[model samples]
Target: MGKTPLHLAVTGPSSVVASWILEKDLGLIRIEDVLGRTPLHYCASAANFDLLLKQGASVNHVDKRGMAALHGVCYLGASDLVACLLKWKPRLDLRDKTYGTPLHCGVISGSIDVVMALVEKGAPLNAADANGNTAVHVAAKLGRHNILRLLIQQGADISLQNTNGRDPEAIALDAAGNVGILSILKHKRQDSPESQSILNIVDEDTKASSLDNQVTGNDSPDFLWDEDSMGAAEQNELMGLSQSANDDLYTYEEQQEYCSTTFPKPAPESQSNNGFGKAAFCLPR
Candidate 1:
């Protein structure tokens, strides 16, 4: 019986529908369903919050769960959306009923990009929920190794204890299948963190060990060659006929661009400052 035209407008398959529906009654913009979710909530979850902000959608209204429309913005991993919502200056630190801040939502969404956005926007890194669990705690418990590392790098207070008196590292140890997370935590105690070596060739006797596992291991698929199809004198690297073996795998040099951070800096937000469901998206954008 409800969703009113305004609720549907919030869905915004196109801005035209929202604008046209609003022409009939501007009041629809503030309408809420039985769930207490407003058009702005849907707008934050779907359409451009910038477009909605300009359209006069209320950003403060929370649904039954006490989550502001800004919380829903985490559902979208797009940096553009992050930039738009940051402009609104919504309470970046607002908590949902569970006390989970926007950072927690982004972490739950498992979108590394989204997590970076919140961190850059000055969202609380150590804010705890009703359970005394912080985003770092959640990252470690969930085996989000990369996210956990970034949080710690940003000074998330790995020593912070939850209600149970367990720090993020302790939480990581308690959570099963978190060996990788545990290892990263352990490195923080060491004076020098050791990075895995890429590749290098020594003497001819040890040359075979330098190749990739695929090339040297027995599990590699059979490499077929039509010996008769080619002249015996021609180059036959696969056949191993050449006197000098050219190492194909490890001999190649890495060509990736050098960069300090992954996710591009979060828009115009300050350098110092800084999802929604089981997946990065809870509902269709």
Candidate 2:
């Protein structure tokens, strides 16, 4: 308990070292480093993560640093680790001492995959840290237009001022010359729950109508049967899919693509397509 054996083992070249320590004491999985990081906190490999979880590691355990293994995994930029942790259904919007949520911590790590994972999990896109830094603030400060765009499309509040009173647009505009990022951040609003509810209802209606079309095998004007539209029930099923155990954006993207008939499609391209290039992405925050 004097040191984080799991963290050591995970960072060490020998997986067997971790295996041996864990075998000696399964409780070691819960042991924290001086900084309060657990073995789960140090895991960079999915195999180690799976093994620890199977052995009773708690995904929600926070380290002395005020972050849980879930946030730590996101910070590690391991898509596999992020995928594995979300299946455990860790609490969303849980803040550290600094009030940083997993969404905040994840965005700092440069893993858009992890960011997408949190977004799909319905993590509050508008939630801010003690410093009033929303995920958008962090992304914009770092010039991560892709993450910024994703957060924006998912209804993140870009207009919210941080502790310094700068909105996301101001942060990005001052830090970089990317006017496109500014243009994207400038467009936002308070999404009404009524609209979301209407979306749900419309999805249900689409399903019913699509089912009729399916039975008739007749092309219906109500929806496109191709890459765009699906039955309402199936669409609803996809909307609730964030909690599913299956990993990655495949299901989320599939849902977005299939439900385009109801929700307008937002551009999902990375900044590279806009001439900014991935090479310019800010280093992990």
Candidate 3:
């Protein structure tokens, strides 16, 4: 029994000696085996599409998965191989069983060349997959900001919502993509500068309140200073001074003695409970 041509091509090499064996000695290998690609599938998956194509591989051949060689190239976003496949004019609109066309695969890969090549080749841009996700949706979900921008420019619906009720901004935020998307959205709304100015005013008010609290030794509700912070040490010194300022705790007689010794005041005309005078004490004769 002759070995199948696919088996020979897969195991055989592109070397002159091996080619002679398959071509001259065997004569069993068919052109279809080389084009149908039992070998190209393995090569393309391994990113060896260049070698397979050089070894007389067909660009239009579909694997068992219903994916053409071009589809594989698009998945890898290999511009060179994609260009070669485009040159061959393979069926660009060919979709797999899941309605995943080459254009779908190209967008998922997020390569400009792959997408542009498919678009140029007349691949339908608005087609959605089983999940009703257009290429723009996929790009947004993956947080491919530039790719999303490109799709938008190409008439992709930025407002289109997926089945989960999420729009592009929500998806990008969920994915934590670059803050550039947030800035873009803010710019579109034209309210970013106003919001920023309001925030600055609030922040300045907070700072002013904090400074007043520091000068008055009053702890602001918002400014909780940790015991280990330098601010706490400074606060403790101020609190000590405040504690010394509480003169109401001293006795009235002790205060009068303190005042007399400290200030050498003149004797009062009479010691009495006069409402107009400071409390006085009679000294012992």
How many residue pairs clash (N, CA or C atoms closer than 3 angstroms) in each of the candidate models, in the order given? 5, 2, 0
Per-residue error for 149 in candidate 1, Å, reads 1.5
**Candidate 3 deviates by what RMSD?**
39.2
Candidate 1 lDDT (Cα, 0 to 1): 0.56
> Best TM-score goes to which candidate?
1
lDDT of 2 by residue, 29-139 (tens): 777755566667656566667777888988888766466767666655667878888888888777775427888767877789899998898898888776667888778
Which stretches of model 2 miss by more than 4 angstroms? 12-15, 97-99, 187-285
- Clashing residue pairs in candidate 3 are none
> If ranked by TM-score, best first, what sequence of candidates would result?
1, 2, 3
Q: Write the per-residue lDDT of candidate 1 for residues 205-255, one digit (tens) a residue.
A: 343232222132333211111132334443232111223323211111110
- Can you write out model 3's per-residue Cα lDDT over 81-121, one digit (the tens) per residue? 68766766778766553325677677667788888878777
In model 1, the clashing pairs are 105-275, 106-275, 109-275, 119-274, 122-274
Compared with the true structure, all predictions reach lDDT values of: 0.56, 0.59, 0.47
Q: For residue 39, what is the lDDT in candidate 3?
A: 39
| TM-score for all models, in order of appearance | 0.63, 0.60, 0.47
